[model samples]
Target: MALRRRALGLALGLVWGFAVMFSTLWLLFQGSSGEIISQLKYFYLGYTFGYEGAVIGFLWGFVDGFIFGVAVAWLYNYLSMKIYR
Candidate 1:
């Protein structure tokens, strides 16, 4: 079946964004520290290591996931068409 690119993109965006938001919040609550989390601060616009960071990470994750999902879905559809034909 052909993938619905827009719907998939939105779905992935929301899921990934919320996941990142919650995970970051959870880690902060647990007082966790890591290189990855620190590095993520650079990827997330306006992200720090606290409450505001979660919000900023969510937005960045959403945009990043949406673009990635769209590209992946398009590529999958293109490849599937080629293979089937």
Candidate 2:
């Protein structure tokens, strides 16, 4: 694949991830705290490792964001691959 293609895919992935995070958070917030507390706990479970817990939480959340971004790229690549194949 060309560099341009990769760059475009990455950009699209970041955008898709941002949208998904926003939508998911919005949906989660629509209900009372009692309704979504457990989900948030599970969502942030990636932060439960070593080091300072709070910093770990923030950093892990950043990672989660990037992974979500990559997922967007993955979907774009999938579509491209399908079309080209």
Candidate 2 structure quality by residue, lDDT tens digits, 1-85: 4224455545655554454455445544564333432344465664332223334444445556556666666777788788988
Candidate 1: tens digits of C-alpha lDDT, residues 1-85: 8898998899899998998889889988888884467588777768777788889889988998899889989999999999998
Candidate 1 deviant stretches above 4 angstroms:
33-35
Model 1 C-alpha RMSD vs. true structure (Å) is: 1.4
The C-alpha RMSD in Å for every predicted model, in order, reads: 1.4, 7.0
For model 1, state the Cα shift of residue 82 in Å.
0.9
Q: How many Å off is the CA of 56 in candidate 1?
A: 0.6
The superposed Cα distance between candidate 1 and the true structure at residue 67, in angstroms, equals 0.6
